[model samples]
Target: MKLLPMFALLIAGFIPLTSAYVDELSNERVFFNKMLEVLPGNWQGKYADGTYENPTSDWQPIEVNYQITSGDTAIIENYVDGNESAIMTTVYHLDNNDIRATHFCGAQNHPRMAGRVFDRSSNTLSLNFVDVSNLQTPADYHSRGIDLKIIDHDNVHVTFSGLENGEDSTRVFALTRSQK
Candidate 1:
């Protein structure tokens, strides 16, 4: 009779711990899956700013198509200035509890860009990248940075900031989701 009571108490204590362990595992899977969903697709928008020499006249639309190859890999193809195209590849992974993306552009010439993801939600996602190395122009020593925020499944807001002549300037980009 005494053993029965002790066994009951032990089982009661073990139940809560097991439940918590299962819950933690489930949460991790949910977060990982959500991260994958917001990362792949096509995004389009326009860039605007008054800092350029021909700001008003140079207002141009931009479109980006992204394909997430895996949990840690993606490719982005961008179109700007009506007909100019640029291709960039990014490899993303979790580091120090934060998601980081290493981007490469001009695959043969100006490749090697690095960035991190700071925020993500159900309907919104944001990415920030700062140029670390530029093989395109060594004398220029310029860095390009971008912040992209998704407002919905089809609309996004982007901010482009970069160093020019050792000074920083910013431009805003508004985009809509294009049909795949």
Candidate 2:
């Protein structure tokens, strides 16, 4: 029938459109790999009061160290408070250009998030959330997303989003490269 031929043509036409979308995703994946290429070093951090109404000069300093291993295929990011107790360890890598992180939280679950490049430049790489794992539902206790921006070779900023009373609450950190 004529309708059958028209439907087949329509479906055939969509194949190339889908292929183009895949190619775009491929380009985005390359961007995430570029972000990982600049992330291996020890770093220090200070408070970021989002309100901007208070002075952060008197704020506390913290330690955040990064090191790559397994032939530069994995990065271990450790966060330490003033008391010298390492609080969290996040491992990051690229799976076919889709940046992924497994956050070993102090809590029970280690949530994983897939990231897409939110913004990228010569000095910054920002990753927005694409999807998440280790969460059963919306009410689960897990890190829902992360906003990671690598600023230059020595500075980075991060915001970890979690559910607080059924709403999204974020913990932000500003980090600088540590003097060895």
The candidate maximizing TM-score is 2
TM-score of every candidate: 0.53, 0.69
Stretches > 4 Å off in candidate 2: 1-24, 27-29, 48-60, 121-141
| Residue pairs in collision within model 1 | 45-175
Kindly list the per-residue Cα lDDT of model 1 for residues 1-180, writing each as its tens digit. 999999999999999999876654454334434545654667676667743333543567677665656445333435434453554444544443344455453333232333333343532233454446544554443325545454555666655555545667666666777775
Number of the top lDDT candidate: 2
Least lDDT summed over 10 consecutive residues: which range in candidate 2? 49-58
* Residue 96, model 2, lDDT: 68
The 0-to-1 C-alpha lDDT of every candidate, in the order given, reads 0.52, 0.67
Per-residue lDDT of 28 in model 2: 50
Predicted candidate 2 versus true structure: per-residue lDDT over 85-112, tens digit per residue: 7788888777765667888875556777
